[model samples]
Target chain A: MSLSENLFYFLSFLAIFSALMVVFAKNPIHSVLYLILVFFALTGHYILLNAQFLAIVNIIVYAGAIMVLFLFVIMFLNLKKEGDISAKSVFVKVAGVVSGGLLLLVMIASLKSLEPYQLKADIKTDIGLVENLGKVLYNDFLLPFELASILFLAAMVGAVMLGKRESGERNF
Target chain B: MVEIITKIPLEYYIILASVLFCIGVIGVLIRRNALIIFMCVELMLNAVNMLFIAFSAYRGDASGQVFVFFIMAVAAAEVAVGLAIIVMIYRNTRSVDVGELNKLRY
Candidate 1:
């Protein structure tokens, strides 16, 4: 196998494994850490896809900033204990498994109908570069682009409002 | 050999991404921990992002990738607000179990 293939396989495996760990890890902090691993693996995949800019931004926004915020909240909350996980009824487990199995089956069946097509690596050198993305974001997607900041503003206000304590509440 | 795998059809990516998406759905269903469930949601989003990139590359257009950018933005906003809500729930109920938060089910 070529180096690129080997790299792809290795990175994909890492991504899947870390994603599983995010769900399996008991500690919230550990779960977040696993999520960081998943993001890093995704960045690797982005690089392989010739999206160098997306790769870096994925790291910066997800692994760097967002995870740090997650870590802060997790730590602030001090939710380290493995509290009672939940009352896991047999029916719930069965339902989860059956639904998941059905979804997978449907996806596989649909995918079987697609004709195979090869990708040429003839990527534009400008692909995923900051300048190119910026140009598109400003030109073609200008309106939605401007509106995103408003979305963030609304989210920030909502979060702060949610964090505020109720007048009668005793804790937190 | 390198070229061959690099040129593997878009179908492979679609199948792989679909599998990941299904698994994420399962995780969301099975896991009761609020944090784990959130991670599952992230997993599902990433799976979709994979599909988007695959299609973008296949179509020879960057627009799909641009949509991926929007998805990322929405995801970031979601994570920020979602985690805050989770924190608030935890603070109030001292619990993060989905089954416990039944006030809205009515």
Candidate 2:
């Protein structure tokens, strides 16, 4: 009925469609491209929710950097040859459907039973802005913030070591 | 157009995020490609980030936004390292099929 609603619906549809393609696409490159689409749609959703900083960062980091790496690696691997088994067995298909259906039912039932609470009209639109987020990051979440950086450093070293191909491996 | 956004309830965002999360789970289950599985993982993370942002916006608290920041950082690091590992696996085995990499089975 409204522009925001229309935008939400449009982005949501794109997100779901691209997500489906991420799974269904036969080529890994295409899968990465669809993932990029999903990330962009999510960035739009973030912007609509008043997280302008997140939207920009999401595009810069996800759609820009991470997806490029995904594409690069996919290309480097030369994995153009489709897998031998592209189709799933009927049993796995049934199990996947059943599990997803069950989870959906549970979520809907819980949400329905929980009464909605009225929120205060006071909004903090600047909460997600870079400056405000940075303040909170240092003030309230300082420990976790520092720890996360350490984790990233460790992950970086680990990845470099892992990706370095070993010289020899004799199969017994 | 700007006036219409104020009327939107936080529940709508939560519901949408839940749907996205579910789709991610389905993708993880039904697909075998390592890269796609990685994408599904990212989808799940994004869905959770949406929920956090929605709740933060509704409560007028900045904590949720901080968590989203942390989630983004972790996700970026994860994708970087995970993709590198996946590339290594592909090079070693020459296959990215999930079912084919079941060597850890007991």
Candidate 3:
């Protein structure tokens, strides 16, 4: 009945639709584009929740950086629709859909039945602000934050190692 | 505390994220392209991230949102490595279809 409610529903529909399109798009490039749309919708939801920092981070990290990485790879591969396996079984697809639907039903039925928690009057809304989050990150989560940098270093090394070709190998 | 109120129930976000996650699962199961499957995994991660953010905002707790920050960090690292692995596989097999990569099927 309010603008926020309307925005929520609209973003929800956009996200779900774009997600499905990401799966079913005939071209991998199209799939990547659809995925970007999904990320944008999720960013909109983050803003609606009033997590301004997360909203900006979501858009920058997800839509701007990560999706660009995906698009670069898809284009580098030059993957065509015909490059996909031509004779995929209908049964495998049906089974995947049915199994996923079952999981969705179970999760929603179990989780949605619980009563939603009401926000308290004295709740700390400013916690989502960058200043407060930076304090928490620097103070409480310092160890994990440092460890994540190590993880990034390892990932970078692994990617370089995996991507480089052997000295004697010929291009196929 | 900013006076902005999210009157939409957490249940809606939960359901929306659930549906998004399931779509991702289905995409991974049915898609043969390694890159598409990779994107689906990202989709699932985003879905979970949304739930974390929703909970964090509603409870006025910063921990959950901080956890989401860690998730995005890990996801960034993950994508770098995963795409490289897929490229290696493509170079080796000359194809990116998961069905054709049967070397590990033992």
| Model 1: per-residue Cα lDDT over A79-161, one tens digit each | 66766467568898789979998998988997777666645567453456667777877889989877899999998998898
List TM-scores for all candidates, in order. Answer: 0.91, 0.93, 0.96
Model 1, TM vs. native:
0.91
Regions more than 4 Å wrong, model 3: A168-170, B1-6
Write model 3 residue lDDT over A1-172, tens digit each, in one string.
7777888889999999999999999888899999999999998888877788988998899889999999998888878656455546999999999999999999989985697677788877777789988998999999999999999999999999999999886568
| Candidate 2 chain B minimal-lDDT segment of 10 residues | B1-10
lDDT by residue for model 2 over A4-121, one digit each (tens)?
Answer: 8889889989998997788778888888888899999988888887777788988998899888988888788777878544667988977886797678677767787767757666
Ranking by lDDT: 3, 2, 1
Docking class of 3: medium
Candidates' RMSD to native: 2.4, 2.2, 1.6
What is candidate 3's CA lDDT for residue A116?
Answer: 69
Who wins the TM-score comparison?
3
Ten contiguous residues minimizing lDDT sum, candidate 1 chain B: B1-10
Local distance difference test, each candidate:
0.78, 0.81, 0.89
lDDT of 2 by residue, B1-106 (tens): 3232366776677677877888788888988888878888988998898889878767778898888888889888998789887877777677778888877996
By the lDDT metric, which is better: model 1 or model 2? 2
Off by over 4 Å in 2: A170-172, B1-5
Candidate that beats the other on lDDT, 1 or 3, i.e. the better one: 3
